[model samples]
Target: MRLHEYQAKSVFADAGIPTPDATLASSVDEVVEAAEDIGYPVAVKAQVHVGGRGKAGGIKLAESRDEAEQVADEILGMDLKGYHVDRVLVEEAVDFVNELYVGVTMDRGEGKPVAMVSTKGGVDIESVAEETPDAIAREHIDPAFGMHPYQARKVVYDAGVPRELARDVASVLQTMYQLWDDRDASEVEINPLMVTDDDEIIAADAVMNIDDDALFRQQELAEMEEETFEDDLERKASEYGFDYVRLSGNVGIIGNGAGLVMTTLDLVDYYGGEPANFLDIGGGAKAERVANALDMVFSDENVDAVVFNIFGGITRGDEVAKGINSALEQFDEIPKPVVVRLAGTNAEEGREILNDELVTVEETLEDAVQRTVEYSEEEAQ
Candidate 1:
């Protein structure tokens, strides 16, 4: 899961990493209050999930209380990369003599964590890799041994960090690595890590994405996940005990397993249909969970039709059928069509239970996909 800048910086501070003193504001009055408290020359940053906030005018410098309020009014409720900004982080605007980039991320190829450093900061790091690969220094860190202090210093020095600030930067890198490991983070980045004229180092901008699979162990981080998922559908799905991923398509997909859900997506594309989402209800789902899954998928405005594909080994088809009936009955009216394909344990009984005019029941996956596509096409007309 991705974290907003303020949330990521909170994690950084929790790990003992220094960051600019900041306050969260939800209103213009709050922004001015924070700015006044933090002193003049504060930065008002939109707390959205996407990057390029600065380029999109989601970030502004306020040298006074009035400017802070004005900037706050402009940023709050403004759309950044399709996400509405509900809050802003009012931070102390400091003068930095130098800026650097440091991050710890998973190296999927090597199956280990890697620490990266670059002199270039406040810009896209991928662009730096593409334009000038030589400027970035990367060191692979073994999970067993952890990141050594010497290894951290070597990366910063190779990136040409000045001798006076090398140790401080190195310390920050180690703390970042520790945070990544301790939090089970997939990635942790400090962009434009700045050194003030006084030679003090601090993280000016932070980005972090934690591994979803590791959330069970990181309860605090899991609780904090609510801050990022503002969409009602996404929030509801999390409340339910299932996995859901949004997609750009007309056909909403609900399947029993991850593998089946993925294959269903490929087949939908092959059959000239787009999938609106990937929802896995998991094994042995009951009527309530099934109802919850359907409710979540139907909440997406883009979904024109829904496909329920279940191969019941541990999950009985009858249970799924009951769930579908319950959901459809609860709603006074359903504008979209539903295609259900059931196999394995009590499939016949399940199909018998769901003999409704609104639901299209299919005997095979191919038939279900074709019917779903046709229904979506019909809905478009």
Candidate 2:
């Protein structure tokens, strides 16, 4: 679950991290009042879950009440990356000389949590990593032994942080680590941690994502999942109780396992086709479950064609085929063409049972993916 900037900042401030004083407002009047109370030169920021807010005109500086009203009126009720903005954060602007980045996340390859610090901040860290890999310093922490103060100090030093502020930066890094550990968070980040001319450090932005599995024990964080859904498709996927993720593309993908679904997505990309969604029906899915999955995918306006990639193990190929046939029959007219690639148990029987008019069966995954891409492209044209 991803937390909005205001929520993340609130959590950070409670954990003793220094943050610029900010007020949450849901209207232009509230923003003007907050700006007046917090003094001039405030920032009116859209409270949305997506990034690139500043680039999208979702963030602006307000030096006076008139400016605050203008910014708030423009940002509120605007669509930012498909998310509707209903609130804004009025924050006291900071005057800083330098910006830095600090974050902690799991390094799946290393099987440990990694702490990273970079002097090149206030920008996309991924871009910095790709262009100048040496600019970011990393330290992997073992689960047996949590991150130590020394490790934090070393990371800042290696990142070329100024000596006079290294201690304070290390302290903030340590606190962030503690928060990540105690809250069962998957990631914690502070971009553009500001260094003032007076030698004081303050966090200018916050981005935290909690582990979904760990939310069972973290009740407080679990309650913060209200506005995380990007659209109605996501909310419907949740209601349907399947593993579904919406993506930007025209090909709708469905498989029986997580690995199979991910592989299908990759193959679609390799074939120069964009996948609109990833829907894993899991092991031993019944006809109704498959129908539900199809319904969810077909609801997405971006999906131009559908692909069913099933390598039956515990999942029966014949059952999957029957589900596809049943789901298609429900439509008054075929919503879109479907491509099915079936392997493993009952593969031949499954292929024979499919409705050829609605679905084209391919014996190989590569053939199936390529055909699906072509189908989507044809639909687009």
Candidate 3:
């Protein structure tokens, strides 16, 4: 689960990481009041789950009450990457001489926690990584030993952090690591760890993502799930026993496993089509689970066509067909076309069962993807 900037900052502050004074506001009046209380030269930042807020004009500096109110009013209802900004964080602006980046994240490939420090901050770290990989320094921590103070120190120093502020930066890294460890977080990042003229370091912006599996042990973090869902469809899908991720495309994708779903997405893209969402029903999904997956996929209006690419190994093809039929019966009318490709166990029987006017069944996976994309393109016109 991804935390909003203010929420992440709150977590950081609790872990003894310094952050600028900030107040959450939902209205122009609240923004003005918060700005007044926090003093002038404040930042009016739109609170959205997505990034690139500044590029979208979701962030602005307001040195006065009138300016603060204006900026807040402008950003409060603006859309940033499809998220409607309902709140703005009014923070006290501080004088800073340099910006740096510090973060700790899980490295699944290495199977360890990696602490990364970069001198190039206040910008997209991905861009920095792609353009100048050497600018960032990394230290991988073993689960048995965990991250040490010296390891954090080495990362910052190697990243070219000022000598005088090395210890402070290392301390912040340690605190960030602690938060990540304590909360069972997948990622904890402090972008633009500001180095003020007075030699004080503060986290200007923070972002964190907690591991969903670990939420069982984290009561407080589990409670934070209320703000995680972007829409009712996603929330409803979570209630079911499937994984769903909404994407901006016309073809809805449903597969039995994560790898299959991902491969389907790649094939769709390769064939000049875009996937609307990623829905994994998991292996050995029953008819009810398949029905739920179909319901969730059709809930998305953008999905012009849906492709069910199931390589039935442990997941029986006939059961998947029954679920599709059930879902079709539930809907009053076929809102969009559905393409199904059932291979492996009982494939022929599954194809026979799905020989209905409601869907088109294909013998090959590539054929199914192509037909789905073609149907979606035809639907567009």
Measured over all alpha carbons after superposition, the RMSD of each candidate to the real structure, in angstroms, is 5.3, 3.0, 3.6
lDDT of 1 at 257: 96
Q: Give candidate 3 regions above 4 Å deviation.
A: 77-79, 227-229, 247-251, 265-276, 283-292, 298-306, 313-315, 322-339, 352-362, 366-381
Screening candidate 2 with a backbone cut-off below 3 angstroms (N, C-alpha, C), the clashing residue pairs are none
| Model 2 CA deviation exceeding 4 Å by range | 226-230, 248-251, 269-276, 301-305, 325-338, 373-381
Worst 10 residues of 3 by lDDT: 225-234
How would you encode candidate 1's per-residue C-alpha lDDT over 162-246 as one tens digit per residue?
Answer: 9999999999999999999999999999998988898998899999999989999999989887767455566677789778877
Model 3 misses residue 311 by how many Å?
Answer: 2.4
Would you list the rank order by TM-score, best first? 2, 3, 1
Candidate 1 lDDT score at position 306: 94
TM-score for candidate 1 = 0.70
Q: Candidates ranked by lDDT, best first?
A: 1, 2, 3
The candidate maximizing TM-score is 2
lDDT by candidate, in order shown: 0.90, 0.90, 0.90
